[model samples]
Target: MSAARWQRLVDDLAAAGVESSVLDKPYTESVYGCVHHGVSRSITMLHPVSGIISISDRQWSKNPDVWVGWQVFREGRDSIVIRTWPITKKRSDVVAHVLEAFNTEDRT
Candidate 1:
């Protein structure tokens, strides 16, 4: 399932003319008392330049729901986080978020 989702994400990005590549290994993220897994090497063109975006898997912790979300970092600068709920949102939503971020960065 993850592989299919990853492929779809890559394909969607390609359709949007965004250059990106996914790593084979799962990336580990420790945040808010929970360990989240994501795709490694998800380098994206956050701007005309380049950036890194992580597609995080939903993690459940007693504290709160720190689930699937996006963390976009541009050229090693501060990250722009876009959080989504339920982790069941359509893949198109992710693509739209990426496109929106891309457009926003393009304007700056």
Candidate 2:
């Protein structure tokens, strides 16, 4: 299921002309999270647990009920990969939003 989700995400991004990469291995280091890259700025997508914990603690204020599964991180110059899911009322909406945001951002 996750693999399918990942592929769909990749396809969607590709359709939108957003460059992204897939992290095939588990990420272990804080500095080298599961997925790391920069869109307009550097961003790291830690493992699901790490991503949720970090976002919850700092950004979402540790809201357990809040969904924080989907995440994205910079893989390299002008590239990023989706690493987890976002808490949203609608899953499709969340995906669309992410793609829209990425596409809207200036690559150069």
Best by the TM-score measure: 1
Worst 10 residues of 1 by lDDT: 76-85
Error of model 2, residue 65, in angstroms: 15
User: Which parts of model 2 have CA positions greater than 4 angstroms off?
Assistant: 27-68, 72-86, 89-95, 103-108
* Candidate 2 local lDDT, 3-96, one digit each (tens): 4555565566567654554444433333335444321211223332222111111124464223334543322233443333354434355456
> How do all models score by TM-score?
0.53, 0.35
lDDT of 1 at 85: 27
